[model samples]
Target chain A: MRLLFTVILAASLSLSGCAGTQQKTLYDKLGGEAGVDKIVTHLVQNIGRDQQVFHYFAEANVKRFKKHLAWHLCDISDGPCDYTGDSMKQIHDGMQINERDFNHLVDLLIDAMYKADVSHRVQNQLLARLVPLRQDIIYR
Target chain B: MWKKLCILLPLLAPLSIEAADGKLIATPGVSQIEGAAGGGLVPWAQLAGYASRDEIAVNAFASRGSVDDYSLDVFGAQLNLYDRLELSIAEQEFKVDALNLNIRQRVLGSKLRLYGDIVYSRWPQLSVGLQYKQLDDALVANLLGAEDDSGTDYYIAASKLHLGAIGGLNWLWNVTGRYTEANQIGLLGFGADGEGYEWMLEASTAVLFGRHLAVGVEYRQKPDNLGPKEQDWKSAFVAWMPNKYVNLTAGYIDLGEIAGSDDQDGLYFSIMGTF
Candidate 1:
């Protein structure tokens, strides 16, 4: 058992070591503006196909959403882009988003990141930043 | 065994519906011994299965453990409704090898999520739960000088998952406060000569390696309400979730003393199927 724990600990350390010195920002790791654009496109496509949360986006403008989402991602990842979109609270004020729908959207976002070839570490970094915004977006 | 299979079949029949997979993979946690969604021994704040607020989920599990002088088999089922409330029922059969006898107990549990989400909400998830347990036969408990054949355990638990908080891996932790007087988790029954309810603390912490595997440790404080010293319990466990539909868990437990048997260490294994 001791050996097993040691191996697990070592494996986790090595895997986390992939972050490797933090010389690059999460935006760079996500391939900069081009990568954010791809991820947003994929997320929009996922929402388009999803039955659980598609209704929330049914009346939304696809092009504006794609642009704002990309900008949001870029800004949150410490990129050089200014987020010209509305505040999370302002945008989702009356949507009456429940926890389930909010989480579904997060799952879609993860899928989008994975499809954009983001590493797990980068994904987690981005997610950590986004987590605090859940309050502003959900149940409002 | 055939009867067990018969019960498991209908639970498996709903697998084709393709609903209740709304929650993230492995977020709901495995089944606890008392049929709650938690670690091997401690119940967590999360509910059972991956069902979200818009869906319903059902789960069934069986677990077995053997110590120096005793063995236990437990089978249970859980229903998670709308991600708000959970109901569970479990039956435990304990084999006392030294005395060549068996002790049976039934537990009915309910939990309600009071606030927050484990991963998303700024605050930790909080839940309140109750477990009503009854020993099928109170003969052994009476011999052990227990006060009652049935008891109830009430607890409030808080849990949270930190994204990449530990070495770029997810880390989850839970703390619970329980009010109970059950001796040996009610196997030897409830209370003692003049004892009543007492507050006990339980805690569990785990590190998730990706979305599939988790390694954790749990500590549960016990009440020595009977003749024998009811020592505390602790375990180190590993849980593997291949997908949303199945989970497997194995652990090494140190149940310090049980009905005067000291250092009752053992291995435990469990499997659960979700729908």
Candidate 2:
């Protein structure tokens, strides 16, 4: 059993090693504050037009929504900013956010990133880091 | 027949990754033999696709593997509905170019996600799977003293992902138990040397890297139902899902020996599209 564990450990190292050392925070890859703002702007622009998802944004304050989201992304990506907003559960509690809505938002976000020309690898990295947050934000 | 399927497969697949592309990328591994989402050579309990309970997705894949003198090709398609049930059909061809002999088989499979979401639930995803395998080479089966050329394998699998479990790394572990009498995965025959039913254990473990890539190893225990000695199967693989519609896997597999053949080890490659 110990031998087997060792073998797996070695295999994992071999695969992970090639990731190449770039200690830059996801914040930098996301192009810092300027880059994040552009993505948030595009995202909000789409929310009002998306038929299946626009209804949920009916009462939303587009300005505040964009700001909060930008700060949230910046903070989570290890950017040089802080998100002092309420927890995901508190913010989405009464909203009755369903999976479809959540996925819609995800789509908008990806589009926003693409508009900003964020590299695919960086996009994937950011998304990966944010995915775990779904448990906290969905159907709470 | 293969030519017609080649054209029909794409029309039935690819949902197109519209956004975050969350559900499709690397989360659900590639479809394995007998049709379950998993590593290259072994099936994990993961359902195929990024679709949640409210959605549906379909995919098809082709794999070609060469080990020493033998060439194995497999193709299949699957439908994942509501992230709960998976229905699939696959065909396999084992060719010995040197011997000018080819054996074919068909696999029909189904898996029910009994409980726990692989990604969301705190508990591991557990599923029950059944695969019905039918071989075309009845002559070889009969000569091998096989009781049947077809058999059904029943298995239950449990899988868990320990997110950020080690060194800010994620790892997945899976365990499966199967009851079968198919030797050489039904290529040589079924129910001969050690007939009836035999229980086998399969295990898989992988490390998730770069969010969209995974490296893993699988160990699948096999039943020595037909003589000459049946060794277990093992493979180490790297799987990548670059986007929602494309997934590629490359690996090295040691399929052990088959019917007096030497230990078969070689490169394995598979490409799949999810819709």
Q: Which one is best on TM-score?
A: 1
- In order, what fnat does every candidate score? 0.42, 0.05
Over B125-145, each residue of candidate 2 has an lDDT whose tens digit, in order, gives: 999898899998787778767
Q: Please, what are the lDDT tens digits per residue for candidate 2 over residues A1-140? A: 33555877976565456444668788888899999998888888888778767887899888888889899999999988888898887887877776756865877887788899886557766766777777777776
| C-alpha TM-scores of all predictions | 0.91, 0.79
For candidate 1, the TM-score is 0.91
DockQ for the candidates, in order? 0.44, 0.16
Candidate 1, residues B1-275, lDDT tens digits: the string is 23794678586776648657767777788988888999989999999988777778888899998889898899998999988999999999999998899999999999999998888878899999999999999999999888899999999999999887765678899999999999889999899888999999999888887778989888899988777788888888999999888899999988888888899999999998888
Model 1's CAPRI class is acceptable
**B43 in model 2: Cα distance from truth in Å?**
1.5
Q: Tens digits of per-residue lDDT for model 1 on A87-106?
A: 99999999999877887788
Name the runs in model 2 displaced over 4 angstroms.
A1-8, A11-55, A66-90, A93-96, A103-140, B13-24, B97-99, B164-170
| lDDT against the true structure, each candidate | 0.87, 0.78
